[model samples]
Target chain A: AQSVTQLDSQVPVFEEAPVELRCNYSSSVSVYLFWYVQYPNQGLQLLLKYLSGSTLVKGINGFEAEFNKSQTSFHLRKPSVHISDTAEYFCAVSEWHSGAGSYQLTFGKGTKLSVIP
Target chain B: DAGVTQSPTHLIKTRGQQVTLRCSPKSGHDTVSWYQQALGQGPQFIFQYYEEEERQRGNFPDRFSGHQFPNYSSELNVNALLLGDSALYLCASSLRYYEQYFGPGTRLTVT
Candidate 1:
């Protein structure tokens, strides 16, 4: 089984400010990491995903995340954020479930990012 | 292409009643999965359907059932609904062995 932990429950940043939302995962085997954003009353949208590639992965809306295997972390970062960036972010981990013969995503509780002017 | 879509944007039901939610997979997608999202929480996987059969399931009760059609559409049926069942039901579509795309979800409120 795999579990994802989002260190912060909420992050508040001023417009044009940089922000980082930390995420950590625990899994026995290889994993895929992803970041998703959800606006109020809407479904989650994929921000970025790390299936297999370089350590750093860039995503939409100027967001990027680094897959640090040693630390078991995949933290999302953005150089600057706009007010519209305010939303709930989720960190997820997907791994092959041998018992089910399929991949399932385990998500973090979520981090609410609020951008202020 | 249209993304995964779910029907009945919102539904209200009473305890002990049964409810069914529908989903249409994205174009070119043959796999559909269902998830439950409670207020202020992340979505939890309920099950996945592929090739007109249930290929995977999560930790849910028997009261939760599903079916997949040849067209790759799907439905989630919940029996004996309880107040605790009030939540958002999300549908996701994906290609086998790939990432999933989600729908806006159907809000189900059980009174």
Candidate 2:
């Protein structure tokens, strides 16, 4: 089974400051990586994804993540965050299932990014 | 497109009762997956529906069941609800082996 681990449960940062949310996963085979953000009482929105490409992946809302195969990490980063960025962020991993012909996402506990003004 | 959509934004039910949640996949999507998100936790996969049949499922109990329509819409039915079942039910839609788009979840409260 594949599982994701988020190091920080909550991160507090001032507006315009840079932020990083660490994520690591354990899987026996290659997997696709994704980042999602959820506002209060709202559905999750995709931030970005790493299917097969360069290690660096950019997402919506000026966010980005680097996929490190050696470390089994896909850390999300934002150079400058706004107060509106305050939300719960989740890191998910998915791998193709040949029998099902679909990809199932396994998510992390989530990181609360609180950007203070 | 309009993205994935769920019906009955909120629902409250008593213990041992049953509840049904509905979802319509995003335009051009043919697969629907259901997830449960508890307070302060991430979403847990419940099951996946493809071609009107259950394709994948997680470690949930048999009391949890679902159905998929030919139009690619889906429904999640929870029988004999428990307080543990109180959570946000999220529905996601996608093409096979592709990224999924989420819908605003249905908040289910079991008393």
What tens digits encode model 1's per-residue C-alpha lDDT throughout B12-89?
A: 999999999999999999989899999999889899998888878889999999999999999999999999999999
Q: Which number leads on lDDT?
A: 2
lDDT by residue for model 1 over A77-99, one digit each (tens)? 99999999999999999899877
> Per-prediction TM-score of chain B?
0.98, 0.99
Supply candidate 1's per-residue lDDT for B111: 85
Least accurate 10 contiguous residues by lDDT in model 1 chain B: B49-58
- After TM-score superposition, the amount by which residue A59's alpha carbon in candidate 1 deviates from its true location, in angstroms, is 0.6
Q: On a 0 to 100 scale, what is the lDDT of residue B102 in model 1?
A: 92
DockQ of each: 0.81, 0.83
- Candidate 1 residue pairs in clash (backbone atoms < 3 Å): none
